[model samples]
Target: MDLVKFFHMNGGVGDASYLNNSGLQRMGIMKTRRIIEEAISNLCKSNIIKYPKTLVMADLGCSLGPNTLLVGSMVIDEVAKTSQEMGLNPPEVQINLNDLPTNDFNTIFCALHEREKKLNTEKITDVHYSPPSCYFTGVPGSYFGRLFPAESLNFVHSSYSLHWLSQLPKLREINKGNVYLASTTPESVSKAYYEQFQADFLQFLRCRSEEMMVGGRMVLTFAGRTTEDPRGEESYYYLWRPLAMALQEMVSEGLVDEVKLDSFNLPWFTASPTEIMKLVEIEGSFTIDHIEIFDVNWEAWKTKKYDNDNDNDASTDDNGVGHAVAKSVRAGIETLVANHLVKQ
Candidate 1:
């Protein structure tokens, strides 16, 4: 399957839409606010006197949801505040929101009015304060390749996106019964997945290197494993085993073909911090300013109150936990699973 053409989070503003079901992703974005503010502050501090008049930033893999522009807005506000504090005029802000060709860019455009209102409202602590002009552009493409001109981006923010692979690994009949790296996955299959991640991540750094200006900053947050062992039993690897089990159960009940189940695999891999360090070193494009490993209770996040009330059907109550999680997973990969299930 051409994942680039077909891969995208579930779009639209409905019960099952990524917009409503992405409470977990929203939480991840919150964790990175301090880091992002620090990066933007540095950007303004370094170039306070003689920087360019326009500040360009991007949110890679900015799928449809409140989060599509959430972090981008935060960065815009930060740059304005930091520039003003340093006694410099706020620069024009151009935000590039990027995702696959199939993503919901229209929704992003629609939300701009409200975002602008909030930005304008928040900047008015004093009548004399002036907020910077903010502009939005939708850049639709894969981040695995270049999507911007040379040295155009000033600050980049990506939240909960990097672990996704450019494509599925060459399974070659390996990992036959599983859809992702799992405890039962063979050593060879595990090696193949890691090899694919290494290649894709290196390419990502290479493209970003050319797109980012000198001394630009990026704050990235994605799932990762701290263990030295790539094949080790980590929570992320274990998280998908239930889906494999469900498919197998359906097969036992003659609800789905075993062949179909055997042929499916998700394009995802979680690299350790050291593995990322090596890739950054090999790519020779960017240096790691700050990196850390943090954990979330995958189960607990589901129960936490979402940022706003929407009839997402991703219930945070105890009784609806399983249904909520299923909705969340569906919001991410319903199309992929539907195609796999119905394909001849």
Candidate 2:
């Protein structure tokens, strides 16, 4: 599908939706946030780093709205609670919410504004509240370069985002027969996925190592798979392939030209726990504070519960599925496929 059309069909559904309460509940974002907060609290208790005032945080791939605010609030609340328990003053905090330039900045800005208004009206004077700032940038490209200065950040957190690389792999490098717009074979695609992830992830860690202060903590949560299928029949792929095939069928019916479908590839990848652990080992700077797999309660479209819903209701559920699929698809597209699947 033409990039623009594909985006029009699927836009505002990926990371953007994940930043909202509905999508967060479906993807266990609140649970992940709690885990991250606890980790930050533990780090504070150990005195591995100073409390409150010195803490600076960044949320990589923070989409557009409420989740960004929630992340900022969670960090601040955790720091304040920890500081009070320790009889120390709460820290000065700066949260940088980062994402691709194409993300909904207006929504993020609005969310931040709302958060600030709430804090001001409540006269929340306990901790110094700094407005969350946002940066339009992608993880693989400019994240380490201009977004943050050297040795400035105290904590780094990314949820359902890091699996994507800055870009896709090179077409010339892959085997001939194994290549397809969407490869279903595990071996053919897994090697490419692993290679790109290993490289981009190592770069991510190295960049963070430079950006973070000594003893800083980093927490990342992402979608993972039990199987090694490059194009396996998982719920994620099931959600997207229909859309992709729909677009392709549109091409066949002459609703759109072949060029349109040719330009698009499904974006998604899933990493096993072992694969992630190996990548961490190669990256070296980050210590694995905790790794927990939580269930993502996806309400599939073809399920009986969805059959009776109206288009609006179906679309809402579709948007949730879209969010989950985007994370997985973006990972595969960016990390494994040679073709540029994700628009940006």
Candidate 3:
């Protein structure tokens, strides 16, 4: 299947939509808020913004949801505050929210005005109440390739995005009845995944390098494991294991074909920090200024606090955590399954 044409989260603001099922993803944005602020804050403090009248930034893999504006708005807010502190004219922010062509970009487009209003510029005593003019353009395409003109971007931010490879790895030995790297997956399959990640990640860095100005700041947070063991990568287990088990149960009940399960594999990999560092060293476009890892509870999105904190309409009872997770997984990969696994 052509992933660019077919791959997308369940669209519309329904119960099963990615718009509603993305609390865990929202937590990611909140968790990494500081890194994003610090990057743009430092950028504004430097001579970079002093020269340019425009600030170009992008949110790669920005699927449709309330969380879509969370980071983008924060960048605008930080730039406005920093410009106010320095008594400089704020630059107009040009935001490119990039994703596949099939993503629900309209859902994001409809909310840009309100996001612009709440820029948090209390410190700016200009009395005119002027903040940076933010222009959001939905770039409907994959981030695995270049989406911007050369040296045009000033800053870039991506969270919970890079783990998705451009395509599935070429497996010499398919791990039947599985969708991702697992304990029973053959070493060759795991190696295939690793090599694919290395290749795709290098392309990603190369594209960003050519598109961004020299010393342009970027904050990237993705699903990365600390363990070197591919078979034991924690995020994959939590993210894919449950869905794989459910598929296997269907296979046992003869509802799903064994051959279909044998051929299907998810196009995702959770690289470790070391693996990422090695790629950056090879890519040689950006420096490893700061690198760290933090753990979130596997069921963090199941908390009642998440419902109250985020605009997500997804609610989970104590026992509904499992069901919520199932729905969440479906929101992400139902296209892949319907196209590749269930096609008859």
lDDT digits (tens) for residues 268-328 of candidate 2: 3567788788878877777786888766555543232432322221224344565555553
Range of the 10 consecutive residues with the lowest summed lDDT in candidate 2: 1-10
Report the alpha-carbon TM-score of model 2 versus the true structure. Answer: 0.72
Error of 3 at 165 (Å): 1.0
The candidate that wins on lDDT is 3
Each model's RMSD to truth, in Å? 2.5, 6.8, 2.8
lDDT of 1: 0.81
Model 1 residue 316 lDDT?
A: 56
Model 2 stretches with alpha carbons more than 4 Å out: 1-26, 48-52, 123-141, 144-146, 172-190, 259-263, 300-344
Cα lDDT, model 3, residue 46 = 80
Residue-by-residue lDDT tens digits, candidate 3, 1-344: 57888999888888888888777778777777888888888887787435468889988998988878888879988888888878788889988998999998888877775554655533665684457888889998888899999999988888888998888888889796578988888999999999999999999999999999987998898888888987884756676888888889998898888888888898888998989999999999899888878765436668746424646447354556777777778888889999986747
Question: For model 1, how does the per-residue alpha-carbon lDDT over 1-344 read when each residue is reduced to its tens digit?
Answer: 78898888988888788887887787777777788889988988888558669999989999976777778768777877787787777889899999999998888788887776776677465764656888889999999899999999998888878998888888654677788877677888888889999999889888999999999999888788888776566834445777778889999998888888888888888889899899889989888989988775556666564344243334454656677777788898888888787545
Clashing residue pairs in candidate 3, if any? none
**TM-score for all models, in order of appearance:** 0.92, 0.72, 0.92
Candidate 1: where are CA atoms >4 Å away?
117-125, 235-238, 305-318
Candidate 3's displacement at residue 302, Å, is 2.2
Q: If the candidates were sorted by their lDDT against the true structure, best first, what order would they fall in? A: 3, 1, 2
